[model samples]
Target chain A: MSNTADPVSYLDYQGRHKGILGWILSTDHKRIGILYMISMLSFFGVGVILGLLMRIELLMPGMTIVTPRVYNSLFTLHGMIMIFLFIIPGLPAVFGNFFLPLQIGAEDVAFPRLNLASWWIYMLGAAVALTSLFVGGGAPDTGWTFYVPYSVRSGTNVTLAVTGAFILGFSSILTGINFITTIHRLRAPGMSFTRMPLFVWTLYSTAWIQILATPVLAITLLLVIAERTLGLGLFDPAKGGDPILYQHLFWIYSHPAVYIMILPGMGVVSEIIPTFARKDIFGYKAIAISSLLIAFVGYLVWGHHMFTSGISDTARWIFSLLTFLVAIPSGIKIFNWVATLYKGSIDLRPPFLFTLTFIFLFSIGGLTGLVTGALATDVHVHDTYFVVGHFHYVMFGGTGMAFLAALLYWWPKMFGIMYNEKWIWRSWAFIFVGFNMLYFPMLIQGWMGHPRRYYDYVPRFHATHIVATVGSWVLVTGLLIFAITLFRSFKSRVPAPSNPWGGRTLEWTTTSPPPLLNFTQIPTVTRGPYEPAPTPTGGETS
Target chain B: MKEQQSLSYGSYVLVWLALVVLTSVTVTIAGMHLGALSIATAIFIALIKGSLVVYYFMNLKNEDVMFRVMLLVALVTLTVIMVFTFFDISFR
Candidate 1:
């Protein structure tokens, strides 16, 4: 053991704390991760309900159960909950917090207490956002992007929504600060930069984006709050302030915000791909470098979102090209993953299955993204279901699928419980089939001239709308089964063993449900992260 | 004993002073009528202040080579983002 003193004895004491207090007051990364998962899952369910209401309203088009006013409010709430509450904090807060230290062979994160504080801040932000529902004027209807002028003039609870977002931004920044410090200060003796796992590299890249981009969002929101409440005149057009500047500032953070959502998901895929392939990842440095490239290029492409919003023609053309250029690094990653799988021992386990599905779905998403990125095409498809389908393919199919894959891949290690493999396969099939069915119809409907964000639709769009609604039910059912499967697994009596997937990352070097101090002794890395090591004959020897 | 030695209180105070001074200068400059030069000046100062926070307050200056490289990579990426954004906006 690296720690010559009695490390196990110290950890044993930490494990014996009382139940609710143990979780509520604990600084342990594992407990904090569980807390994030629980909170995000609740948020995800709320967001999904809002989304279902949207699809139901759009099924036959013209004002089904609510007025346009209520319809606008529903979409606004859906977008805010999903983007801010679900995807922004999705994988990074859940998996990044739990696994970054473990993979780097650290005892715990550099600032354990600070980690707990970040979660409380996140919870507080969620509370503030939910409280807006009960406010006198109802919630904000300016959509989650909260563009100014309209947001400034809206009658809904803009103050409450903006404040909640501002608070969440702080929680994000704190997590970024903590991750950066831990990675810098706490790596094991021999874990060099080149020797670090791809997951850590992705987290490092993500931390940079989080720190740099989130502040822009905070300041932009503050400007909006001031304009609304204090008459700051920053985004008010009549007052000689350029409303376009508000769009620029909003997308400055919001665009990189996509990378914030996907980078950690990319980290999840990186960890999953190598273990199941049973080979060193192909072009490791290329993959690592491309991750940073994606994060960097992601910021420049925000202007593409505003092409139809009356941005200048020259600006539109520039954003168009930059948008295409940003796709290169993402393409590089896809190519490398495919090459990694070629002529290799491939496992058809649930995690690997999800990774494969992510590749296919994300490719379609990326191509559709290109269509939207093109100035000529975006004008036609802008604000249509085409854009909606494209994002859902990327965010929901790409990152959401990867999030589930990572959870299952690490569940054995995190909770020390083994789920049934049959149930895992069953749920993956339902989700994969159901998801495509749900989203695929949107592309056609959008192409057929179905405008998005409209409470009512023309009779011509009804056929595709019915199909889309049916697919959504299937998707929801699949998700329900997936949730139940996980719940049943968590309550099972059988204990899981570490290194269940024969993974080579340092996280597998410890016991399942690792101690509060993740490592008893800091590990000394001697090989590259994905180097082929002999498989353990039995399970992990902790 | 080792943990105590790692905590550098003096360095933290020094870094905070430097950051405060830099921020004040930036804000003062921003208030001036530099016309087109204002945005550039503000960003440059913010960059410097942000660097000081990373290097000293965070102790990244004394950390491992990998951390230094990571920070440098991030800085370069930040520069690229700003330059590219300017390219698009100015061309319009």
Candidate 2:
């Protein structure tokens, strides 16, 4: 962006083909990252619309718009799209791919061709997932967890859907392997493990979870498919299998999958807080190590999901304790972030503001998570709307907020464009209010003993459902405006600075839209990632 | 990486004593009938002993910090899972 007449960035560079084909076939990490961004936003839009329809159907209760069977399919597809398609692969596939190599001062990932393959595999997986909706018995009606017995008996296309999830897991695993190798082997000279950016640290930790745990998910899904098609007895009680074991394996990966959904967002906020707060991070070692600890400790707590399934009291209480342990690392991150913001030259910019929202909402999600983790409380709210609200607050409020922050923080750098600040603020107001308005009601109604995934709720639950549906309208309006602002930025003459946010990371060293090989010359990082440059604007600073 | 430290025979004996004490603490906690805390405490003690064996006897202490950290992560996760499953089967 510093160049008056734009230099050749990854955007302008061409390879074997022209235009879209060039982009698809390109091995460039940045191009693949852009492809992921475009694809994820498309899926997110569909997921949101599905969610909106579900909210509307719930607004008045008693078959307002959809049949009970149709409602079941809607929620199932919504969860599958949002989780497998958007959030799980969200940050790492998009921002991580784009920024990881850049921050570590590598030209591209360690496996560039493999990086391209991961995206291709992702598309194939997505195609398989989407195909299930149209073919066979229409969409799957078993809620996304695909709880067995029910999953085994459902006439809808559970097999195709589970197979799609299994393929998506392969894509996730390959991406994890690519990121791990790139981080370990490609850090620039003097950029020791301690010197890499916090985002890189989070990616490193997340990649391990992806590779280590995702295979369990693949195996679990495959078993579901095998049961549906081959009549396997691994999960069928009559054939001598316990259905409880299925929940164990699913959550074993899926709970850590929750951390995978969250950790990168933590990483994004870590970058945003230091840059906007205008101070080095507080407790860098703690934040860095906690990322790993969350990934590690996350595996111990999956059994809390199975308390009502008769998995024995011993497994129940032990899981409850380990679930509480997760709060420690999560709390460490929250405290360290707050300390970073305290008494610093704070700038309430777009990214940092998004981060503030994340902290508030995710804290609610975390504390309520404690309520959900306790054996006493969990038994009451296991399938209730309170559980639904807690999940949304964590996944959508926590991960979704951080995803917005990452978009705002990197939009300028990624494409050499900056969004209108005034519009961004207007959108943020609606989004922050609407997100809480929609999800908070679910918590209250859920506590009133309202169950989730039901076509008709008792009349007592109608008020909160209406409130949530209206909130969805407001939230969608905000998102539309936010999208418009970014679209409008492409034409604005406002030049993006090479280092727009005055970020200390290596990505700030090059042109705003970085060249084919990220840096003109690879940067040698001497100080810790957040350390300010010596003598203002020397090497590694614009 | 720093120079790897080798322990003297006295240090090894101290480690062995600590492991023995941790094992007894587990037995004592179980004897106290601390209910859920008993399982948690026993697992905690088991983790400590397992860490000692891995860190000292297996020479994980001399390797890279990431390796030791990784091993501890793996050991802690697997031990809890294995023990938790054991309790589930035993109680049934």
What are the lDDT figures for the candidates, one per model? 0.83, 0.89
Q: In candidate 2, what are the lDDT values of residues A1-542, reduced to their tens digit?
A: 46755557888887789988998999999999999999999999999999999998988868788888899999999999999999999999999999999999999999989999999988888899989999989899999999988999999988888888998998999999899889988999999988888899999999989987898899889888888889979987788898888888898889999989999999999999999988899999999999999988887888888888888888788888888999888889999999998998987888888999999999999888888999999999989999999999999899999999999999988988778988999999999889988999999988889988888978888889889999999999999999999889998846678887888888988887899899888888889989888846422221
Q: What fraction of the true interface contacts does model 2 reproduce?
A: 0.50
lDDT of 1 by residue, A462-526 (tens): 88888888778778888888888888986773576657787888988777767667776777888
Q: Looking at model 1, what is the TM-score of chain A?
A: 0.96
For each prediction in turn, the share of the native Cα contacts (below 8 Å between chains A and B) that it retains comes to 0.32, 0.50
Q: Which regions in candidate 2 have their CA more than 4 angstroms from the true location?
A: A4-7, A538-542, B1-83
What local lDDT does model 2 show for residue A210?
Answer: 93
Colliding pairs, model 2: none
- When summed lDDT is taken over every stretch of 10 residues in candidate 2 chain A, the lowest stretch is A533-542
DockQ per candidate: 0.31, 0.32
Q: Kindly report the TM-score of the first chain in candidate 2.
A: 0.98
